[model samples]
Target chain A: MQFNANTKMAEVIHVNYLLLPILNRFDIQLGFGDKTISEICAEQKINVDFFLEIINSFHDYNYFPQDRLQSFPLDLIIEYILKSHYYYINIKVPLIETTIITLSTSSDKLQNKYVQLIVKFFQEYKEELINHITDEEIRVYPYMLSVDKALRSGNIGKELVEKVKKNPIRIIESEHTNIEDKLFDLKNIIIKYLPPATNYSLSNTLLIELFRLEQDLNDHARIEDKVLVPKVEMLENQILQKL
Target chain B: MNLKKTIICVKSPIIYRGIAYCIHSIQPGIELEHYNNIDKLLKDDNHEDKLFILDINLLPDPAFYFLERMFVNFQDLTLIALSERFLSDKLAVYFRGSILITDSEEIVKNKLKNIIDTGKEINRTNRKNSAISEREQEVLRLVAFGFTNKQISDQLYISTHTVITHRKNISSKLGIKTIAGLTVYAIINGIISPDEML
Candidate 1:
């Protein structure tokens, strides 16, 4: 089922504006406000359906009217994005960058070529990718963390948690489609590092090294996409109830 | 079918629960007891005459301790393996005369019955082969196939002294005095083929 943050039709009475600034500062310090998404969800006994719905809601920019943020728990949603989405990318992308650097400087020519291709791929997609990361960190994660803190301290009240519950995490997941497409494009380009038959010793050595680097990157990306991101989002929601 | 009491000794609660569910569903009139710690289960005198279901994932050290103790203490108890997916491949060479391997509870129940029935049949077929443990059978198979103590140790990844100990146990159990006698007995009991012996 899709999560709808606005479904509860809670009256859009303006709360204190100071709360936003306080939550934003809190989110940055707590690494998306403490507990990880997976741990929170697991602790809260939140179902997979609810988790997916919440994710989808965050990424569904077109369907979710921009003005709706005033009505929705904007701070909490931002925290979710920061911890669940941006945090994983933040941790993984640098590792991938380092791997690319290592592969490029390898003495083997084949390895260098493969690394060069990866570097080029990242360079080409840099704007779109960086923007995605920045948007999550700046906008989505902080919001989610605020909601988490509200839920945990019993300060926000159950009405807010129920409203947040209605909003599916799936919205953000839908936006991941674009992100995944770019990642796949990079992966496809990187796959060319496989060992190719060559009489030249230098080319053959480079190819083997390149193949290994590609494998490492692929594994790194898979862990980020499959495990880390979802877990982080879950944590943000859980922290809402606790903090 | 007579109601047989089965005891499952596995480390993982998920697997243990899954097996318990399957065994309860498939086998009627069978009592299934689950234990995470084999040592605790073994210490209980109530374990007598019950089918012992072991997971190979539970083995190689701490689990091996239980297996060795069981061989010494509970000779009549039939021990069957609820194996990990990879264990079937790893243990295939030794499985011929040693452990009966299965992944599911229903299959384990059926295999346990077969082992019990086969135990009875072996007793009827020849009294001389009645006392061999699964490990002894494994050592016997390796020995019959012409593996020296060191070779057997290397193949099984055990010490040569351990291989020698297994060999000694095989001789004592089967009433065979020499390696040649052990080889002849292993061949007659289908532990190893003549070609394998060469």
Candidate 2:
């Protein structure tokens, strides 16, 4: 179901409880009783259209409208992305890691060893994820923001030009591959390899969290690749052409 | 007999669980792996003696090629097409049998039981090629240990080309392509100990 500005805020969560985190990233909280999405967005000073797009994209995987998302100001999308990165690093990663740690401690000796291996594998993935996020935060996002500023103010400064020429957003477009592959492997290891003696409930929880994170990251990557990069590339071209 | 495991690749969680519940009820000790997609199931599984319950609608574009790949690559697999409605005879030819989502629980159990028993009987008579050879197992062991084909060939005193062919047959027979997957399979099956991995 597609959510719109007129849709009640509480009903969205009723449809999919998984969307609660996405709503939280938007600074939306519970007790939005009988309030329409636009009403809550207006109160929080959030862009209603952008909020709807984000919620709809998360709610329905196939509902991402690339053109509509690209039409938003680059900083707006970047701000949302920054919030997502925060959610991933500070929230999702910790939750999954802690769960794995707890699962390892609670299992039998043999299962515990495998869980430890998984913990190590997950640590590697987490490191790679953090590195990727750090690159985007320190290098890529700042570069895109500067380009956004140049495009907005029509002032292509020397530093901004050098930055654009030095680090094109296209370079890291395929960087999501390794992280994605590692996540796939992690899931497969749990699904097919974990022995029958392991804790089913805990394994189920880990699988759920991993699958959620995978979906969230995939959607986030699609936005970055399909929308953010192309928009920034356009801004870069405009700035260079004027120069 | 490779009937100890089953892989269900269906989109609907309810149907997947329902079928799994029936299978477990019928054969409590069976190893069941559930997947929502066909490609992941095919790639990660050890297809030897494993029954695949595939959602017909979830097949990739050019589904015939995928079905053909299963027929050619994995001779030991018993595929059961799953759908909410009846399938045409042409498409139905791809499956050893078809399970309708609308089948009652008892009906489903009987169907699964028949498949499991018949699968074992069929494999016992003429399935020598379906089993992994000793040389192939040695190659798989080294492969899981992160050895290259040349290294495995050298250790086993086989030609590199023979090692490659063995690896191909191992992958085709087992449906496990990644080193990590094979390693996990080796550990689980006791071909390689978890300590060896360390």
Candidate 3:
């Protein structure tokens, strides 16, 4: 049922309950080492929205230190990489590997070829993902957090704040852009996972999983853009006021 | 002309709070006058020869009526418009040719000295476009137009104490020691033309 725009928040929350359990399972599978991507989906029960939210929250939580007193701690940055980047790769790689295995065993040659193409795409996706996470943790998050602390304490001089504000995150976000371009290219190659003739069960399952993964990453980028950058900007202003 | 004591008029509580803060920060010597209505300001015996800070928003419709009255009654009084928003038509018709407008107290103190300096400039030909910082010109024009301290405060959306501080700065910069001195300086400087001077 379509809900009206003016629907109450409580009603929206109630509707969300239908998918909650599936989302909880995805979260648990992603959080724990219990199930591979293929195994998680083989169960045929998952909450797509909740799964996206978890991915988005992981990205946001990593961008800034949750402990206000820690003042943009280093550990938070590492944890972000561990959760959003490393964990994502771990789950996705096995799913692709299993899908490739399932495709190989299929009776139809067209279905086997489709799975082969997906496996190749996942291989390149994993490489790009690793580099993106490393660059953020090593360069971007540290500089941003440091600048935030300096601004809050009023120790950051006017000249420095002006300079940093002008540039903000120079290297990390640029790399992210490059990585996103590659992801887009990969997506185009997959072409919405359209299976050739003779493909049936494997084709449907692969399409479903790939669509879900694409959605999860898109959500991850959005939370970073909206919540993380604004938080950093606020911190920068507070620090500048002190100086 | 012996520089006479400066006087300030204001109207609002929020602006009065800001003015109090500014005064506490920068203590300038001047006499401050507070009034709730234009009637009280106009009825004052000391209206003539005093620098009046008026809140343009407080005046009734066809503001020219009040402007003309002040111009006719007090020949040497300087009027300034202290207001939140200075609409172009209102400014052009009522304040443009006569009064100055300002929004913030800090701008008033910082820019008043420049307005006074430019006013002292004998040849008006060399006057720069922003001869007075926008804020100082605002307070100066309001003072010239006959606004009370409280009225200026309410109109500018600042504190009455800020109006007082702006007035003190206006007096010191013009080297005017009294309200009469400020009025004469304002007239001589052409801040308010002879026709507009009250």
Q: What is the C-alpha RMSD of each candidate to the true structure, in Å?
A: 25.3, 17.7, 25.8
Candidate 2: where are CA atoms >4 Å away? A175-177, B1-186, B189-198
TM per prediction: 0.25, 0.63, 0.35
lDDT of 3 by residue, B1-198 (tens): 121333334568555455435433444554455665788767765643344556677787777677666657754554455665544442433332222244356545433333333333223222233234445555676676677888878867779999898887765554444443343345444454434442
Per-residue lDDT of candidate 1, residues A1-243 (tens digit): 233333211111122221222223224222333444444445555433334333433323233232333233444434443444443345545655655565566536744543454565565545666776676556545555555566556577666555456643445545642444444434433333223323345444434444443433343344334444454456446745464
How many residue pairs clash (N, CA or C atoms closer than 3 angstroms) in each of the candidate models, in the order given? 58, 1, 48
Relative to the unseen true structure, what is the C-alpha lDDT of residue B185 in candidate 2, on a scale of 0 to 100? 55
Where model 1 places Cα greater than 4 Å from the true spot, the runs are A1-243, B1-3, B59-66, B85-110, B119-198
Q: TM-score of chain B, per candidate?
A: 0.46, 0.57, 0.47
Question: Tens digits of per-residue lDDT for model 2 on A40-117?
Answer: 999999999998998888888888899899999888898899999999999999999999998998898867866877
Which candidate, 2 or 3, has the higher lDDT? 2
lDDT of each residue in B1-198, candidate 1, tens digit only: 243686778888877777666566656657877878656556766544566667667666655454556556655555556653323322332222223343234334433434443333232223232356655766776676666899878756579999889887766555565454455455445444444433
Off by over 4 Å in 3: A1-82, A105-115, A151-167, A178-199, A237-243, B1-198
| Per-residue lDDT of A80 in model 3 | 41
The per-model DockQ list reads 0.00, 0.14, 0.00
Best candidate according to DockQ: 2
Ranking by TM-score: 2, 3, 1
Better of 1 and 3 by lDDT: 3
